[model samples]
Target chain A: MTDSIGFGHHQHACTTNNCTTPLAENIREQVQNHPCYSEQAHHYFARMHVAVAPACNIQCHYCNRKYDCANESRPGVVSELLTPDQAVKKVLVVSSEIPQMSVVGIAGPSDPLANPEKTFATFKELAEKAPDLKLCLSTNGLNLPQYVDQIAQYNINHVTITINCVDPVIGAKIYPWIFWQNRRIKGIKAAEILIEQQQKGLEMLLERQILVKVNSVMIPGINDQHLAEVSKIVKAKGAFLHNIMPLLAKPEHGTFYGLTGQRSPTDSELSALQDSCEGEMKMMRHCRQCRADAVGMLGEDRNQDFTLEKIESATVDYQAAMQKRITVQAQITAQMTEKKEQQPHYVQFIPLTSIKRGLTKQKFVHRPILMAVATKGDNLVNEHFGHAKEFLIYEASHTGVRFLRHVKTDLYCHGDDSCGEGETALQRTIHALTGCEVILCARIGYGPWEALVAAGIQPNNDHPYEPIEEAVEKVYKEMIIAGKLDEPLQQQLGA
Target chain B: MSFTINELCTNCWACEPLCPNQAIYEAKPHFLIDSRRCNECEGDYPDPQCASICPIEGAILDSSGQMLNPPGSLTGIPPEKMSMNKI
Candidate 1:
């Protein structure tokens, strides 16, 4: 298993609470590095927003997620709605409150382009305002064709479309109707318009080099059995990422976004789908189901600043806004105040940046005595270097010589493919898992290099040419010169 | 709780290292316990260990009644145990 096909990297994705390893992991990794977000990025970093696109040219029963709109929304969840301008203002106000806000996206809240002017304006304003932020837009293909150029023009990185079925008969069950070229088409025709648009949109965006992440919401009673075909077709057409989101049956977010809100697929089912697509296409199992015009990482919400009533007050007036907002927010204020009377003052503020930074610790240290076995078998390992802290022995097809005469430390090495750096992946995983000081390897890749640095693994790749014995001798000599090798090896070598 | 571990476990020990909880152990028949430590990274990131790196099928079972772990993770049931039972 080479870096392209190995399952070592995605293991990190599968460990947390309710996560799924993408079915097609190899393809998933390839797709995730689409210039916007890498596979390594945590979903906690991305935020979601349901756009107020109220105008999807096509309709998928599963496409009913919304922003926190004061207007009617999902049943239990509280949502506040804002226009494009308001969305930006809210974003600027909230980002300072949350640090992991890196990417901004407009998902279904409604089809972004269905409300073309607003979506584009939001994108434009966000780009101009937050130049460092990446932009993502999800849509129904009915409007995708028209916006591909614009998507590319703005250098928007991620574009997800809900494509449930390629077969019109099956597609009809998931989608109710579509508005195409000014006409409302329903049944198979609507399905065809959407599928055609989906295929066309996917093709065009790919041709233009925009990253397309296709989301296929798996419904047990709907298109669950035949979803792999969707993966194959999209992969063939170059859709970079495929996310088969679990169908949430919440009473809110439309009928499908959480419709039945019945139990979604099991981890096994999700893993099966991911496995099916493993070799063929990249799969996105780490979706946050973000809100439209969401600013930040996937599955994260940053608008903790304003509430439904307070939002309108936050509208252009920061000073007068509070006074205006307070009048409108007064009623909810009483409800909150009443609750506060019954509850303690409790708040949960996440220090995400600090934790993420803590996860990545990097420092550089120098060691003169280095040891590596050159012969076959347990060769690449042994006690040799003067400043040996630990000894690692990796199982190699060709073992190295047993250098018994040398300085000692601890023993280490792994024959397991994922245990040691596999020429491309080990440096990173080791750095993340073991906290290695400096990984000495034959070759390295960007993924491993970054992973190591992120884990604070100082890697020294280019080692001087010397036999294992010679290298150990050099270590002792260097240590003696530095006045630290007062050990037995140094004494035996008569340094 | 939509998952399970199938009979495809080979005991190569590839997955034991990947699991966050050290959930897989080298017991009698090459053991693996849920301990529910595998929450699918929901409150955390996403996905459980058995589904991520297991090379063998049926090793890590998901809610769909399928083996999520792939082929290589199914290192085998072990020769010592198999031979001892026969003897």
Candidate 2:
């Protein structure tokens, strides 16, 4: 697992006795530099989605399918819809400008499968023009089975299918209707056809050895309770990863769920569901639920920079860009290796039960606590609390400090005149950090400091610009000395 | 009542130029709809320009504090049926 941690550029480890060695190696190579497939690769590589597919075969309650929504960063929203030729040009321009660009995907202003001619045309052009790039697409699975041959012919290896539910009754609630056989079917009947098609498509893709990633939207009071079962079934069906994304239902986007006051799953609720499903399969925790026209690294969107008007006049030298990308990626891999070596060692505390059995006198228990650090990259606790857009979550215990995942949040301080009106943003940030016991940062304002303390999270700025793992270890020791480790997990989390 | 832009706005400038009444204005951390000048596009387009073009869900609200493009409006899926487990 450690060997798979760096930039995903490392060679695959094939055991001599394993029968599936070649297949395993092939899978590794497929996901190695693919940002969305491998979690570690996202930190180093970049991906771009071209919104060429504008028609969808099914209607999802959570999707609005709006264009020219530059501010919104959700799926199905794009600034400019592009033709197949325009999409190829945009990809070339973006790849040249952002040399780390490795994957070109068609995720939709609508379903890619719904617009097969346009989707495949773009892929065909890309395969001929930019042969070095990895090709992928996200689909609703309505037309996936039909397009499997075309997908393989285009050298597209990664396919994401949004599977909300297996049960038709539950599926009916999420999907109102699906267009099949030149007719629009509604309710349970519609859902049944969609579910059947999705399962068949998934199986067909797996049979073809195409890497399949299942995406499920966690709708609170709806599919949330049923996702664990979905995870188990998908994992059994041989899905490489399961990304359970939260339903982005805001009353404003004007989708069905949003209008009815249907609330999105809270960060804790979403994480809890993810943890439960994680035991069954690999859960994708770092997905940004990027826009259809998203460009750049995960959690960062650069679509505005590569709009149709902007890239129309641009010329791309694919050969030169590919050369630069190789050199840049090599340096990133080396840096990641050095960072791994510099990770600090921590003292693992013996379990309370074991201590009790051995000594029969010790009453205190050492509990593992989660710590969130605000960093502007370089793996350091150097970012101010207000300026942080995301926090790197870590678990510090007697077992030592271990990196977990990053939690994205709204900026609490927008700088200058925005500070006074950041009440809601601050609340959202605090909500996002619900499970963490400590917030390690360079600086925090008085309002947020008080809020953090009230929320049972210790806001610390004692170690400014210090390495994250080392600082986390220091804070863990301090907690131990302060006897805070003796408390239960719930108390530490302020639950 | 006029349409209002809430804190959820990322100030992406999508609605600023599309506003028929010229009510949506740029502000810190988000965009704000000037209530005094805002007419909710009553005499113009059937839908408020800000809410029609705004990407972030629930960012724009009507004078009665209701979202102009509430969740069910776009997909036409009823919200009551969405909570399947409850029923």
Candidate 1 Cα misplacement greater than 4 A, ranges: A1-8, A11-37, A48-52, A63-78, A250-263, A293-300, A308-495, B1-87
RMSD per candidate (Å) reads: 24.1, 11.0
Best by TM-score: 2
Task: Write down the TM-score of every candidate.
Answer: 0.47, 0.74
- Return the TM-scores of chain A for each candidate in numbered order: 0.54, 0.84
Model 2 clash tally, residue pairs: 12
Q: What is candidate 1's CA lDDT for residue B35?
A: 51
Assess candidate 1 and give its TM-score to the true structure. Answer: 0.47
User: For model 2, what is the error of residue A271's alpha carbon versus the real structure, in angstroms, after optimal superposition?
Assistant: 1.6
DockQ of each: 0.01, 0.06
Error of 1 at A393 (Å): 31
lDDT of 2 by residue, A136-249 (tens): 999999888898988888889999999999999999889877767544567899899999999999999999888999999999999998999999899889997889999987
